[model samples]
Target: MDIRKLDDRLSVAPQITPAEVTEAAALGFRAIICNRPDGEAPGQPTFEEIERAAKAAGLEARLIPVASGGLPPTQAVAEMARALDELPGPVLAFCRSGTRSTILWALAQAGRRPAAQIVAAAREAGYDIAPLAPLLETAA
Candidate 1:
């Protein structure tokens, strides 16, 4: 898993295997947030598999799957925000390439964090967040 830390409490990553969930717990992650919908790819592990692994590792987990290519829906952002508020940190959130997970985090953080700070954080983590500038600005 190519885990990219966005901050002290949250990290975004490309899809992780069930085994990696165990590793994540070992790395001090207290929760897992799955942002990828199952079956988006042919061989990716399902959320249930990850959840089971998380449970076995004594970590909380939640699935707020976002569709592959688009701005996350308002409800999805709301759910993500709730998860961020409630899940024990540090949380590991994953999607196909980590973009969706990052996007959801960015949107959810809007109005709470400055747009520039959010964009800079994602960019520093290797995501090109230029496309989100306008949305991030207005979201605040």
Candidate 2:
């Protein structure tokens, strides 16, 4: 897994396999969040499969799938916030390329920080988050 730290509590990674769950547990990630929609790519493990493996490894897991070209739902953002509040840090999330995952992460953090600061942090991490600016404003 090519994991990139977004902050002290959160990290994003490329799609991971069931085999990586144990390693993630070992690394002290208390929870795993899958941001990729199931069946988006052939041969990708279903969210259930990863969730089962994560649970067996003693880590919490959840699916908050995000569709491309659509704005993230309020429930999705709420669930992420619940995860952040309810689960112990640090948490790890994954998607096909990590862009969607990072976008969701930033959105979930919207009202907690300034939009400019969030965009800057995302940019520093090599993600163009300009499209989310308007959404962040509304969310805030």
Candidate 3:
């Protein structure tokens, strides 16, 4: 897994496999958030499968699948916020390319930090977050 730290509490990774859960736990990630929709790519394990593995590894797991080009639902954002608030750090989230996960994480953190800072952080990490500006504005 190519994990990128978003903050002290959160990180993002490319798609991860079930076997990676143990390593993630070992790395001190207390929770796993899946931002990729199931069946987006052939041969990818379902979110439930990953969640089961994470749980077995003693890490909390949450699935808030985000469709590309779609705004994240309020309920999904709330769920992510709740996970961040409740789960111990560091929390690891993944998607096909990690873009969507980063987007959602940034949006969820909107009110907690300046919007430009968040966008700049994402950009420095190699994620283009221009599309989320509207949502971030609304979030603020």
The most accurate candidate by lDDT is 1
TM-score per candidate, chains pooled:
0.98, 0.90, 0.90
Which regions of candidate 2 deviate over 4 angstroms?
A: none
Using TM-score as the measure, the top candidate is 1
**Ranking 1 against 2 by TM-score, winner:** 1
The per-model lDDT (C-alpha) reads 0.94, 0.87, 0.87
Predicted candidate 2 versus true structure: per-residue lDDT over 77-129, tens digit per residue: 78878887788789999989888888888888888998988888778777889
lDDT of predicted model 2: 0.87
Off by over 4 Å in 1: none
With a 3 Å backbone cut-off (N, CA, C), the pairs that clash in candidate 2 are: none
Instruction: Note the clash tally of each candidate.
Output: 0, 0, 0
